[model samples]
Target: MSAAAPSAQPKLRVKNATKAYNTRSGELVAIDRCSLDVKAGEIVSIVGPSGCGKTTLLWSMSGLHKLSSGEVLLDGKPVNGPNPEIGMVFQDANLLPWRNLDANINFPFEIKGTKPDRAWIDDLLGRVGLSGFGGRFPRELSGGMQQRAALVRALSFKPSVLLMDEPFGALDAFTREEMNQLVEEIWMAAPTTIVLITHSIEEAIFLSDRIVVMSPRPGRVAAVHDVPFARPRSLEIMSTREVFDLTNVIKREIVGEQKSRYVRSSDAPVAQSAV
Candidate 1:
C-alpha cells in the first residue's frame, strides 16, 4: 500500500499570543490568547472593527511588537525580533521623499549590505505598471503609483512572508480596486505567504484564502472563514451570491461582538466556517 500523505506544515504560527499596553488608564489588553496558522504561499486576512487589535496582532507577528504572553513562530522557531524573512507594507507608502522610485525599491538591498538586482527590480517595476517611472520621486507619483512602488519595495528582497496593514487604505475607491487587481496579478505570478489587516470585508473576501474575524477590544479570534473561490479571482466574484452570503455572515459576527459590552480576554472557542 502507498504511504499516507503528510499534512502540510504552517509556515507561520501564532500560538496563544497576547499583547497588552500600560496605558494612562491602567493596563489595556490589545489581543488575548489569539492563535492562527498560515500555510506556505497562502494569503490570510484579518478583518475586524476599528481598535480591535488587528494591527497589534499583525505587528506582533512581524516582531515589531513584543507579546506579553505566548509566541509567534516562523519555521518552528520563535520570532523574538524583526526577521529578514518577513517584509511589511504600511497604509502609507512611507517612501523616502528624497529617493526616487528605483532607489526606494533598492533600499532593502542596501540595508542588507547586498547589491541590488537591477534585472529583478526592473521586472517588478514593469509588473506593477511602474517600469519607466523608476526615476520619478514619490512626490511625482499618484497615490496609487506610490503604493505600487511600496509594494515592490517590500517584495524586492523576496521575503518568505509579507505583512500588509491596509496598504491600499489611502487610495480612492476606483484606485483601490485597481491596486487590488494588481496585487492579485502579482501574487498569481509569484505566490507568497501574506497576512493582511483590513477593515473592508469585501477586500478580505476578495484577497484571502481564509478570513479571521476578531472581537472588539482585547481582541480574540472570534471566527475563521475559509474562502471557497479559486485562485485568480476577479472583481465579479464579489457580486456573487456565495460572496454576499459569506460577507453577511462575517459582518454579523463583528456586529455581535460589538453589541456585547463585556468581552472576554482569555482564550475563547473560535468558530470556523467553510464557504
Candidate 2:
C-alpha cells in the first residue's frame, strides 16, 4: 500500500489563550496573552521558569482549567472543558496500586464506558516493552516500567493531542534519557500532536521539532526556535555541539527574561485571551 495520508491539519491550536486565578481579593494571572499552534504529529516543548504559568498554559489547552479570557481550540472548535481528544500525562505516574499494567492502560476506556481495543492495547504494551508486564502490579515493576505503563495509559486512547507536564521529571538522569527516547518512539508509532513542558533544555531540543520559550511570572512567548535535526534522532545527539548550541540559545532567552522581576502582586490579570 502507498504511504498513509498525513494526520488532520492543526490537531491542536491555541490562539490568544489566557488564564488567571480567582482569589479572595482579586484575579491572579497565570498566563498572559499566550498563543500557540501545534500541527498534526508535531512535538512541541515549552520551557520556562517555575512560576511562569507553563503548567497553567498546558492545563488550559487540555480544558482542565478555565481560561481567564482566551480560547483554546481543538480542530477549530473551542475547548471549554476536559476534551476527550486530549490526554494529559502529569509529572507523577500516579498508577493505581490495585491495577496491573493492562488494567491501568485500559482504565481510561473503562471509566468512559467504552470498550477497550484489545489488539491495540496489546500492540501498545509490546511497543512500550511491557508485553509480559501486563499482569504485574505497579509495586512489582521498576520506576521506569511504572512510567512506561503510565505513558501507555495516557496514549491508549489515541488522543489527537498529548499534553505532557514533565512526565519524566522525577526520574534519575539515565532513566530520564531512556524515557525521552521512549517518548520519541511512541510519537513515531502513533503520531499525536504533542506538547511537553520541561526544565531540561537538552531534552527539549532532543525531542521537539520546536521549542517555545516563555518569560517569567506574566508568561508569554519569549522566543521560539525551530530544530532542524533529522529524523530517528539518536541519544548521541545529546552529547554533540549541536545540542549545546541549541541549549545555549534557549538558556540565554530564558535568562534574558529575569531582568524584570519587579512584578506587582496587585496587577489584576493582564488580558490573556489567547492562551
RMSD of each: 6.0, 4.6
Report the Cα lDDT for candidate 2. Answer: 0.83
lDDT by residue (tens digit), candidate 2, 125-243: 88878988888999999888888888888888888889999888888989999899888987886788889999999889889998999998678988988888887799888888988
Model 1 lDDT tens row, 41-104: 8889999988889999999999999999999999899999999999999989999999999889
Give the runs in model 1 whose Cα sits over 4 Å from its true position: 1-6, 262-275
**Candidate 2: segments with Cα more than 4 A from true spot:** 1-9, 262-275
Per-residue lDDT, model 1, residue 51, is: 83
